[model samples]
Target chain A: MALALDGVSVEVTGATLVRELSLTVESGEVLGLVGPNGSGKSTALRCVYRALRPTTGAVLLDGTDLTALSLRDSARSVAAVAQDNHTELDFTVAEVVALGRFPHHQGGGALSEHDRLLCQEAMRRTDITHLADRGVLSLSGGERQRVLIARALAQQPRVLVLDEPTNHLDVRHQLELLSFVRHCGLTALVALHDLNLAAATCDRLAVLCGGTLVAIGPPADVLTPELVQRVFGVRPTVVTHPHTGVPQLLYTLTGENNP
Target chain B: MTLTKTTADHPPARPTRTGLALPVLALSLTLVVSVVAGVALGPTVVPLPDTLRYLGAALTGGTIGADEVSSYSVIWQVRAPRVLLAAVVGAGLSAIGVAVQAMVRNALADPFILGVSSGASVGASAVVSFGLFAGLGVYALSAAAFLGALAASALVYLVARNRTGVAPLRLVLVGVALAHGFQALMSVIVFFAPFGEAARSVLFWLLGSLGSATWGALPIAGAAVVVAVVVLVRSSWSLDVLAMGDETAASLGVDAEALRRTLFLLTAVVTGALVAVSGAVGFVGLVIPHLVRILAGAGHRGVLTIAPLAGAIFLVWVDLAARSLFAPRELPLGVITALIGVPVFVTLLRRRAYLFGGR
Candidate 1:
């Protein structure tokens, strides 16, 4: 599904967290949101997922206003892997994945055969089918992250929103997870702290600096050395990956190198 | 991190239908046994055979012969209503415990955590001492207590909520503070009661009792619990999602704030009705849900269904012990609950820290 943010702005207690941001992810594309620690990537994502209402402008899913739809209907269209998707209670992996079918069963019926199959398929796709009966809290960080991703997949959403999904992953798991996201064929909006991974994984990149959108385009154009140095305040050397030919950045500490 | 993927052949999935049915059946059977034992083994020690005959006749709307007059009155008029009230109050408390815990997103919340009990105490004390709402005649005390409980919960909601919503921590802190405030107020009213008999009655009500259990009041509490349990069971999935967290629940298409608010009011009414009649029988609400969650998974459907049955069986035995342990002198139900509940709760906590969804 196509997702558009039209001048969406979020103000919490007289402070603007996201300012007049307008961006669009076309159907079946991976759009990466990259920024410094507090540059409002998460804030913008929150507005899309309806965790917070935009102070101004709107979020549209396929030309319909998101706020106008019931949360259940909107959830059917969009699924999210949020930053704080940690479970205190220990639900089995299957049970966690089955919760994704919740929006479909709002009228209160047992899970149908189709729903159960969908959950099994989601677990298999995320490669956690073996852990189906295991308690979520017993899993390693990477395993837990994959379980959450499986849950999002079980929703069978048209649009996906992920906030820092790679935070808990090792380097190998990180690549596998992003590869799955890339091949899943869903329109996705993902926030990434690792610029090299973002450049490698995203079809397009939107860079934010201090609540404003600074650059947005194909990854090669968006990750230019000048823009990186200016926005990130660090000297960056960009190199093309040997296999994929995507632009990858190697950063140097400016003060240490100069001294 | 050492991550070894499991490649062992997975066992066939357990049938969900049988899982829920077995526990429910066991608990239901236990409840039946408790009721029979409770009625038969009281101070009078009626034989089991005669007790069953009397129960069978009473249930079928038949009368016994003149020789069974004493047994008839003892079973039908006295023990039956009291035992049924215990069952109703037990089921209500346990179910409401699940609702309140999920509503506030905290494991510590119970039916009375939001000051409902203390508020009920204030109202009951006023009625006992100053003849407040005496015009309502038979319902005056219960009516005042229910109103006070509801009012206190409403006040807690109004006070604890911020611009966004009631954050769980704030709700806990606000509820505890207001509960203390209400308790102090109850104490002040009891201290200056105009008569010694009024003070004694107020004290008795504060400690809790089922002595007021009557055929007239049983149906009201029973009807309230039935309605509340039906509503809770229907929304069980929503409760499961809500317990995860607000944002996750919203992402799953549940309006978390709206659901929480609805549960708050529903629990208030059910708990208000319970406290009005039973005077805040304490540990049943606090301990029973946790025990159920330990035995069953944290799924609301399973926990909510089984907790009521478990609670009913538990309270029947507790009430039995209260009435018969020191024959002719009855113990307050609250005293017996804490006396039993504390030890069991501590043992469970120390008995290997298995997660709620254990293998």
Candidate 2:
């Protein structure tokens, strides 16, 4: 599937959060959106997830305009794990995972055997099958975040959108979650604050600055030290992985004699 | 099956002692005892067996006793429906209270806080003042109140809902504004209508009464409660996810928007039906749900079943107080519920940490 934001612009209260931005994620490819705070990175993803409508432009999934699809149909097509994961109700992990089948099940209808298997498969993929019966209210932040991702995975959507999914996760789970996303046979759009993690997991990188697509290409081409300095306002040493050949930037605070 | 976990997610184990058997048994026993006491303590007291005999006659479809005529008539026809109406209204209010509080994720929210009761009152007052159903003369006031209740909540929902979703905070804010508007309009009507019929009718409604219960009102209250209970029980699973907030619910594909709207309307209709039959009985909806939440955990399965039972039992006695606290007359049911529920609620509030929502 081809995912494209064609000339996307988002405005809230007469102010533009993201403007005239466009990018694409090919089938089975992972595209990373990286930018500093307030740069429209999350806003652009929000437009794609149908959380916020665009002021102008449109999102297309496999050549079909996303707007043309009903919200439920689009929901079945794309699943989201957003940063706002706070919940007031206490549901067991298995119950939470089972909710991913809601788009398919109507009133008084139980999940089919196939749906149950999918829920278990998704939970196992997230390494959360052990916590299946645990109350979500009692889980730590990192564990709950994984559960959210697992819930999205259970949706079995062709495309997955994650906005800062790793925000509350620990270092190890963060790496594991991203690497797992990369290995999953699905198109993924991810917003990340960590440049190194983005470079490592992303097949292609799109740098967002001031609500616009400043640069889009492979990590090597788009994440130069100069680009990092220009967009993130931080001086970073650029290096390549010893075996994988992916460009990774290591950041450091510049001091009096640093330049 | 036991939940497998080396590490407890929430180390502080939830107090799960609040279960079905005890609370239900307690409620059933309370209803029996309360109803009996209510019959025994009313004006022109009858013996216990006589009371039972009269009730049994009603149950077994036997002839009405002569000595038990005024006493039995007063107990069954005049007073029993009134008491049952209290229980019915209380059950509906408390159930709606639990649902709405869970829906909006607010602890302080009661069913009527959404303008349902006052809206009913306004409608009741309008019908009385204008004589809408004087020709039909059957259910003029109640029909008006039910319609009014539905219209007010629907209006509040429409005003609050936006493209993003109907956030609980927005819904409550809109509800408060709309309720004030309804009450203001009601006040103006009260000022104009005559004190004997129109204005006095509105006053009785404001105080909330089971005193007005008639055989006519029974079916409406029964249908509403039955529908509310069925719809809520069927959707108990969703209520758990809903408490988690919209983002998580949508992510799970629970159709968060649709669920919110559906539950909101359900609660409104339930409230309208209760208000129509029993007037504006308050405090039960606000109190019983919290009590159940504390005991049974916030799971909707336990809450829906337990809150209604608790409310129904509690109101049976509260209505008894309304009837027997002064001889030969009855106080408003709302006053008794507030008096009983408020103290119990405060005490319960002090008992636990009382946090709401998923961590």
lDDT string, candidate 1, B164-270, tens digits? 98786787788899999998888788888888787778777766788778899998999999999999999998887776677777778888888988898898899
Top TM-score prediction, candidate number: 1
TM-score of 1: 0.93
How would you encode candidate 1's per-residue C-alpha lDDT over A1-259 as one tens digit per residue?
4999999999999989999999999999999999899999999998887778899999999999999998899889889888876555656678889889998876567889999999999999999988887766677778888998888888989999999999978999999999999999999999999999999899999999999999999989999989997888876888989999999998766566642
Per-residue lDDT of model 2, residues B219-277, tens digit only: 77977897897788788767766776676555444557788888898988888888887
Those runs of model 2 whose alpha carbons end farther than 4 Å from true positions after fitting are A2-22, A53-70, A111-134, A170-173, A183-186, A241-245, A252-255, B1-11, B14-56, B122-144, B147-151, B158-167, B184-204, B346-354
- For candidate 2 chain A, the 10 contiguous residues with the lowest summed lDDT are A250-259
Would you estimate the TM-scores of all the predictions? Answer: 0.93, 0.83
Worst 10 residues of 1 chain B by lDDT: B8-17
> What is candidate 2's lDDT per residue for A134-230, written digit by digit as tens?
6677787778887888888888888999998788788998998998888987899999999889999999999988888899999999988888889
RMSD of 1: 3.7
Candidate 1 lDDT score at position A124? 94
User: What value does the lDDT take at residue B111 in candidate 1?
Assistant: 89
